[model samples]
Target: MKLSVSDSDLLGLVHLIRLYGKNLSKTWSYTITHLIRKIHDQEHFPVTDMVKKELNADSLNKYQRQKLNRRLENDSLMIEHMIAVQSIINVIMKFQYSKNDNDAIRELRSILEANTNCIIKFAIKEKDLKGI
Candidate 1:
């Protein structure tokens, strides 16, 4: 399947988080929150308030929020990611899927890995997954 540079970059950013970024405090803080929400929303499971704090955009600072919003706005890849991720979330939330389910995730991982160079960078400096 073909992907635009922006889409590839967004996927790479996600992959970077799954790899190096997964262990970082910030990554866990943010990703887990997003993950939980995705999982809950997709799986129809309930998440605690504490978990919500992690992914909540309102919890982010002005700069971080601005950066994230810009990244989402400017990147077509990110938009695609949102579409795909949300679909995954919807399936999971409906109880038709589970977190242990790997089909969609694996497929996405493969696609992103295949296009690593195009899939990971954002205009923001901190969003850059190069060193990590």
Candidate 2:
């Protein structure tokens, strides 16, 4: 599906990439790069060559580089899963901010609670597959 995010959400995601792109673990940095490409259609947020160069610096050991390269090779699936997880997080955040009298919050809370077990199962499966 083609997903469209708000400007604020896009900026928030970009800020996250900028803030933690270089500092994250190798796996996470690769994931973040996939997210950046998904959202911005470039390997780096803000589409800057300098940021791309920094992110792709030759600092990784052979194994780490291989892992990162593997993730990059499967970028489409990584982006899809990241987007799905990010959507769930956004919904949870929205529910958290709902007003006390909001009926939508009650409904959403019930839906989320009902799906918690299924979500946990999926998470476990993903963890087993990716060791994440």
Tell me, by lDDT, which candidate is best: 2
C-alpha local distance difference test of each model: 0.35, 0.36
lDDT per residue, candidate 2, 5-24, as tens digits? Answer: 34454444444544554555
Give candidate 1 regions above 4 Å deviation.
1-14, 45-104, 107-132
List the candidate 2 regions with Cα displacement exceeding 4 Å.
25-132
Give all candidate RMSDs, comma-separated: 16.2, 16.6
* Best-performing candidate as measured by TM-score: 2
The residue pairs found clashing in candidate 2 are none
Overall local distance difference test of candidate 1: 0.35
Candidate 2 has an lDDT of 0.36
lDDT of 1 at 98: 21
